[model samples]
Target: MKRILFTSTLAAALAAALFMTAHTVTAAPEGAPAPYRHVVLFKFKADAPKEKVAEVVKAFAGLKEKLPAVLSFEHGLNVSPEGINDGFTHVFTATFKDKASLENHYLKEPAHEEFVKLIKPVIEKVLVVDYVANFVDHGAH
Candidate 1:
């Protein structure tokens, strides 16, 4: 019957549309999600004084104001908070919409560069982990 054929065709079309949408949503931008992770860890040099570390922390916190891509910034001097143990001097997490935004934060933002320059000498090592947002809860933000 013509009705049966039309119904089948419609079902096929709907399936195709759904597949396309799912594919598009899953296909994140380049470097959006790395296989490993996106964890930026910074270790300051031993020569850095306590006051200098505090100053650098303030400067790093100010990055959010200078860059729109950086939606939120969570930073603090690494300390064993009660029972939790974090073995590091400092830690800051920067979240962006995509990898491009993160790259722009480094390239386009002048203040970011200044912050880098200010802490370059005292910085021991920096670790960066880039990854995609597999499952994000919008309500949490």
Candidate 2:
């Protein structure tokens, strides 16, 4: 009977530890800074030239090197078969070190300003979303 009781207690302790570990792994760190993501979606004017659009995308991607705040940059053309993009054809993502870097450095950087000027004429509509990137562990799901 004592052996059975000991085994049950051990099992309960092990289960509690596993539960704590899972929660710890899944929880976001308290007060830790995460990278900021700047997402831009562009819908070009119907008459916008293809070359100009290409140039704009190229210029935006180059901001990663031109701006000290940009940690990474990438862009992609919309290819969703769902046809629910609302006419947004291009998507660009720029990762910054933090919100401060994006708000202070990248926004005021001349290179970014130039890119905005270069793209403005051809761009019909633009949507930008900025957020602190709190990544969830995919495996945890």
Candidate 3:
């Protein structure tokens, strides 16, 4: 009974720690607003060819150069050991100066439209989350 109690307590403590770390946010420098972040996760269809996926990634990476509103663009394959990814294999993050730039300019850009068309057929599922970044104080505790 004592061993079971200890194990449960340990699990709860570990969960709390994970929750805190996950929610912690980075602080921006004094008086500067944090940029808007557009995060996209993709699960490619099982039948999608590797070459086609590579092409899609190449096109997405190219968008940073094409759109002035895009402060940065990055993409990567999922490398997490966590099994909860729900088959999402690729992740992309695009940063913008503000929400207007992302929603109005970048999203409507001709190159972006073309890139979407390139990716749509090969993707099984897509999840997008956008936020204006803000700092949360959780200084190492």
Clash tally, candidates in order: 8, 0, 0
TM-score of each predicted structure versus truth? 0.59, 0.76, 0.77
TM-score-based ranking: 3, 2, 1
Q: Is candidate 1 or candidate 3 better by lDDT?
A: 3
Taking every candidate in turn, the Cα RMSD to the unseen true structure, in Å, is 11.4, 7.6, 4.8
Top of the candidates by lDDT? 3
Looking at model 2, report the run of 10 residues with the lowest lDDT sum: 20-29
Candidate 3 TM-score over all chains jointly: 0.77
CA lDDT of each prediction against the hidden true structure: 0.70, 0.86, 0.90
Better of 2 and 3 by lDDT: 3
Cα lDDT tens digits for candidate 1, 1-141: 999999999999999876666555433445555322235667878788889888888888888787777777887666665744333566778777667777765546888778889988878888766776564333331
Candidate 3, residue 102: lDDT: 92
Model 2: residue 67 alpha-carbon error in angstroms: 0.5
lDDT of 2 by residue, 35-122 (tens): 7899999999999988998888889888888897888888999999999999999999998878889989999888888988999899
lDDT of 2: 0.86
**TM-score (C-alpha, index-matched) for candidate 2:** 0.76
State in Å the error of residue 37, model 2: 0.4
Compare candidates 1 and 2 on lDDT and give the better one: 2
